[model samples]
Target: MKSIVLFGAGNVATHLFRAISNTRNFRVVQVYNRTPANLVPFQTLVDTTSKMEEVKPADIYLIAVKDDAILPLVKELIFRQALVVHTAGAVSIDALENLDRKGIFYPLQTFSKTKKVDFKNIPICLEATNPQDLELLEELAGSISEKIFRINSEQRRSLHVAAVFVSNFVNYLYSEGEAICKENNIPFEILHPLILETAVKATGMSPLAAQTGPAKRNDTQVIQSHLELLTGDQQTIYSLITQSIQNLHGKEL
Candidate 1:
């Protein structure tokens, strides 16, 4: 069994801490947070510390802080030769201690602080400075997730960029739809079956094949009605996505 230390108590860390603490091979040996108030919830297994010197030793150190904070935090603490890794999808493993040894353990899923994550189906993308450590990461990440991918820093960054469009931006469009429905007194439930069906179809069919809407059908009257309903930025998103769907179908939308 390997001892593990967690270095954040935020959404992703909270979810991971609960998981590691319950797993058989890895233990939450310690945890640290800069804010004293953030230390309270994880006080049980974590030896709370605002001071870096107070953070203890463990086989692996899981740095789960926000991306911008990672570099400065790494500069402040010395890991005492323990393996260290971070969970940022956009940041690279090279951003960690290049000389001291580090890796990446990025989970490809939207992690909302209030929502629960099903680790079973989530894909974990991993990379490391050393092959042995990379193998260890693959093993550890695979234990929690069935999908494990070994990708370099550049590929990870590309995946992150695409994720912003597919995950984050798509959710923004969903919110736009919700707002339009609410304003017209139309229940959003009418779109629920369509949304779920789209997702289901995309699983076995290409996103291009799953594309459906007045845009894909080239029903200009329906598209014009949807455009008229939008006021500002929503109208822009509607125009862009509809254009994209049209381009995909190689016809007017």
Candidate 2:
């Protein structure tokens, strides 16, 4: 079995550990975090440490820390030439260039500690400086997920940006919808079906084709009324998005 020393105890690291635990191909021999309290959860399952120097020998050192901390952590890390890979979408593999073996093992998905994501379907993106390291990453990714892609730094960065648009932005819109419903004394549950249908439609068809709204239809009067109902930041977001939608389908007008 391949041995792994997982760094960081954040959302990505926790999920990665759980997925690896389910598979017999890989064993997380050690887990490290800067805060000792964060290592408590993994201590019973495997060796856990707060100090980086005490990290045990492993086939792979998986860094799943915050994007800003990745570089500083890499600089301080002292491994016995173990293959070092980070699970970050926006961070470049070049950050690990100082290591003997460096690569990226980014899982392309929004992770939350409370959310349960199926590793079998999540697209695991891999990149390595050498073919052997690439093969190792590929094997590890394949063990957890069937969907694997060899995405470079630039492509992964672009994918991350797009994910922010589709995932983060969409979720914020949901929050806005809920707020609007609350202000009107309407049950947010009424929008649940619409939300699910919109998601399903987006997956089944192009987002542009699935789009439907007063803005998309170029209904200026309805748009004006909606903007009048909104205030401050809400109004700004509504106006900007409405303008964008109109610009996208202006020919229809």
Tens-digit lDDT track of model 1 for 128-147: 88898998888788778889
The digit string of per-residue lDDT tens for model 2 on 82-166 reads 9999999889989886677999999988889999999999999999999999999999999999999999999988999999999
Question: Each model's C-alpha lDDT?
Answer: 0.84, 0.91
Q: Pick the candidate with the highest lDDT.
A: 2
Candidate 2, superposed: residue stretches over 4 Å from native: none
Lowest summed lDDT across 10 adjacent residues in model 2 is found at 244-253
Error of 2 at 235 (Å): 1.5
Candidate 1: Cα lDDT at 93: 77
CA displacement after TM-score superposition, residue 155 of candidate 2 (Å): 0.9
Q: Per-prediction TM-score, please?
A: 0.93, 0.95
Task: Itemize residue pairs with steric clashes in candidate 1.
Answer: none
The pairs that clash in candidate 2 are: none
Query: What is the TM-score (0 to 1) of candidate 2?
Result: 0.95
